[model samples]
Structure formats: structure tokens, C-alpha cells
Target: MLNRFLLPALAATLLTTACTEPPKTVAALPILGERDVRPRADGGPADTVYAAVPAFRLTDQAGQPVSNQTFAGRAYVTDFFFATCPGICPKMQSELLKVYKKFPTDPRISFLSITIDPDHDSTAVLRDYAQRLGIGDASRWHFASLGDRAKSFELANHLLTGVVPDSLAPGGLAHNGTLALVDDRGYIRGAYDGLNAGQVAALQRDIPVLLAEIDGRKKGVAKK
Candidate 1:
């Protein structure tokens, strides 16, 4: 009788304790001081992300209207350059040409090249430039205009805020070769120094990371 009571009491105590005590939580891993391989917070990233493309109406080389909505649900890599740029621009274009070769024109992505010299780079000029870079492939690449130098300079300062005076020449156009990596939502996620090989390599690695992040966000896998 005593042994039977002891067994029942022990089982009852365990049941009560389990019900009353809290469960343990596993700890997450850390990475280089950031939160392990997870996506950074909104504005937590070096570049902030916009939910959608900004409201701006522009035209492509084809004279087709390329508005903000044109980039919806699509990621793109873009930089500013004039067709007759004397320095840096050629190298940047070459680097981007490589990037275009790497990723086919998937609907998920596009390559945008906005001419800083839109006045000189008319539709005919841009059309010829596109021809030089492999025009047959229409899926993911574009060369467009951002209007006059005033509008172009304003966007560089107001929107990009990433330009400087050029010293290589007295009155030559001053600029940076940094390529903005925009997400499908038209938010800038990251940037790359398109003129440098090492930076291009880093961009290559980060490109996939960004694409994956985009996919996760769409699937609701990204954490808030």
C-alpha cells in the first residue's frame, strides 16, 4: 500500500511541475556582431529600402515612357554615365556589361543605365550604345534618359546624393561609379563601386543575397 501511494505521488508531482514551469528557449547564433545570416532591419541596412519605386516619369532609349511603375516587382542594377564619357564611365559600363552577362534578363531583374549626358545621348545615340553592349537580349537591360543636366544633377543630389566635382579635367562632368542595387520593390538595398574589380566581386556575392531576401519577403519568410 505504501509503495503504490509513493509511485502515484511521484507521477502527480512531475505532472504538476511540468505544467507550472516555463519551457527553455534555444539561443540564436551570431555573425560578425550582426544577427547571424538574417536580413537586416528596414533602415538597418546601410541603404534604406523604399516599399515601391518613387514617382518619377522618364523615357527609355526607345522613347518609350519608363515611369516608376515600370520597375514594380523587379530588381535592377543601375549607374549614371554619358555615352561619350572620357574617363571612368567606360570602365563602369564594362563592369556592368559583365554583370549583364552573368544574369540573363530574368523578369525578376533588369539593368538600367541612365545617361548623364542625355542631351547628347539622344535615342539614336543610346540605341547605338545598346547595340554595342549586346542589344539582341531584351529581357533585363535598359539604357534610359533622366532628362536635362539640371534634372540629372538634381536627382544625383536629391535622390542619390552621391556625386562630387571631377578634378581630372577643368569642366568635365564629375561623378561616382557606384551602382545602386535596387530591390523588386524599387528600394535601394545596397551599392557597389562599379569601377573597382574587388567591389564588383563583392557586388556579385551580395546580388544573390539580395535576390534571396526579396524572395523571402514575398513569401513572408523575412522577419519583421
Candidate 2:
């Protein structure tokens, strides 16, 4: 009789404790890409070095050099497109605009749309294109053109997108509508299909997560 009563009481106490405990937190977004484990100089823990976006300078709409340094300390979403794209460009830009509108005034975020047809999409052309999209702040929403068409294609590859000159394709160029989310450290954290609403929604959800992790790191707070 004593054992039966004690077991029931113990079970009830355990159930109550479990119900009152705090909920578990969602873990931080994983840093995407191949990483190398290296020993720290301070002899603490081994550091994992992730692959980062290579440095390249692009001529922005304002004819300014937009390089990795330009986006220092800020997370940016980048996509490849040409100003004259008649097929997917318009749709992709419209989708990206959704993300831009979400953080238009956010100082921690920026947008970069690189033109694959730089020879045709001049600085003035890009500026007008941006204006048509209601983007007045070039610093925040940069429509940049890289004059070296081959280099531009190479850069797109680094962002996990492909760009090729196809006369049969729209605007005489072929490209994927991939929106890549890069962290402040220039690492590719996420990539989404700009043409797909569902993937874009995931991108929207992830941007804040990365931003929150960055902020927490700065404040010496751990992100769960």
C-alpha cells in the first residue's frame, strides 16, 4: 500500500515539473558551405572556417564601386539579372522587392542586383530601372553592373547561380532566378528560388534569424 501511493505521487510530481518547465528554443540557423577546422591561436577551441564569397568590385547605378567592403557589417541579398530581361527578370525582381520592402529602412540589411548584361545595362540604365521599381536609395538597393561579362558570369557562379549568353533565351541571356542570402562575414547562409513564393517565404523567415544571430554575437549573448 505504501509503495503504490509513493509511486503515484512521484509520477504526479514529475508530470507537474515537466509541464512547468520552459519550452525549448529553436536552434540558430546553420552556417552553410564547406568549412575547415583550424586550431585557434588563443588555444581555446578549434575554429571552423566556412567558405566565403570572393571579393569583387561592381559598378553600381551611381557609378560607384560596390565591393565586399561596401557591405561590411551588413547582411545582403543578391541576385543576378539584366535590365532588359523580358521573361524571368521582372518576376524575380518583383519577388525580391518583397524582401526589400521588409527591410527598406533597416541599416543592417541591403540588396544587390547585378546585371549580367552590363554592356547594355549602363549606369544610367540601371538608375532608371531602380527608379521604376520605386527604389530611391541607391545605397540600400544597388543595381550594379559589372563591365566584364565573363567575370560577371563567374561571380554569379560564386553566388550559386548560373548566367550564360543565350541568344535564344530572353534578353539574349540565360540565368536562374536564385536569391542568395549572404551574412556579414560574406558567407552564403541561404539560397532560395526567387520565382517560387514558398522558397521566398523561407528566405523572409531566415533573414531575421541570421540578423538576430549577428546581433546576439555582437552583444555577447548566445543565440539558441
Q: Give the per-residue lDDT of model 1 (tens digit) for 64-177.
A: 767657777667777888888887888999998888777775567788887777788887788888888776543367788877777776555433435554666423678888
Q: List the residue pairs that clash in candidate 1.
A: none
**How much lDDT does each candidate structure score?**
0.70, 0.91
Q: Model 1, which residues run further than 4 Å from truth?
A: 1-53, 158-171, 221-224
Q: Could you tell me how far off, in angstroms, the CA of residue 18 lies in candidate 1 after the best superposition?
A: 33
Candidate 2: tens digits of C-alpha lDDT, residues 100-120: 989989999999999988888
The TM-scores, one per candidate, come to 0.70, 0.84
Kindly give the stretch of ten consecutive residues in candidate 1 with the minimal lDDT sum. Answer: 27-36
- Winner by TM-score: 2
Q: List the residue pairs that clash in candidate 2.
A: none
By summed lDDT, which 10 consecutive residues of candidate 2 come out lowest?
215-224
lDDT of 2 at 100: 90
After superposition on all C-alphas, the RMSD of every candidate to the true structure, in Å, is 11.0, 4.3
